[model samples]
Target: MRTDRIFGLAVVLGALAYIASAFQLQTSFLSDPVGSRTFPIIVGSVAAVCGLVMVVSPDPEPDWPHGRTWARLGIAVLVLVGYAYALRPWGFVLPTALAAGIISYQINPRPMAAALTGIGLSVGLYLLFKYALGLGLMALPRDFPG
Candidate 1:
């Protein structure tokens, strides 16, 4: 009934459930060669392995995060929520760039570099999804360029 063992077991169970749910994803005829299930399966497998290890090597004492860590985590959650909310109205490029830049700035206090990184990631991911992956992501809003 150790904490580490319980946590590990929970992780393992959660991973198994995730894998099971991922298997239910229906794929179209023109899906990728690896299919949609591949990534989830890989992620779940890794989680399961880690969980098993944690269960075997359970830690009696764990270091809990302090105030700063908690604050950062809270900020991150807020930023994510804001990003999701903004995505529809502002479109992919603007919201994504802003989120990335803000998060990067939170980690490292370099505003310019963070902004550039955000812009680069936004554009790069947009192009990649649109061209290479054949996925349609909203890059701009309908009433843009006004």
Candidate 2:
């Protein structure tokens, strides 16, 4: 009943369920060659492999966090959850910037540096996803940017 063993069990079970769900996914008329299930299958396989590896050779003595670290962790989790909820409405760039800046500030306590880092990451990733990947992510709404 070790920590790693529990983690491995969870990983394996989650991956198995995910892969099974992938099989139920309907194929699109104009989808990629491998179809939609490819990513899920690949992800599940990787998770299964990692779970097995962990079960066989778990971390000897994991460093558990304490004190302020727990508070920071809680804040970080809340920030991420907020980011997820706001992603579609606020759009990727703003949420990314906010989350990144908050995390940066949480780590080092520099507001200006955090804001700049957030802006840079948001703008950079927006262009990358839009241009390089040809993904259609929503930018700021027409009225809001101006």
lDDT of each: 0.90, 0.89
Taking every candidate in turn, the Cα RMSD to the unseen true structure, in Å, is: 8.7, 7.5
30-123, model 2: which lDDT tens digit per residue?
9988899999999998998899887887876577798899998899999999998988888888899999999998898888999999999999
List residue ranges in candidate 1 displaced over 4 A: 1-61
Q: List the residue pairs that clash in candidate 1.
A: none
List the candidates' TM-scores in order: 0.56, 0.55
Best by lDDT: 1
Best prediction by TM-score? 1
- Candidate 2 ranges beyond 4 A from true positions: 1-62, 142-145
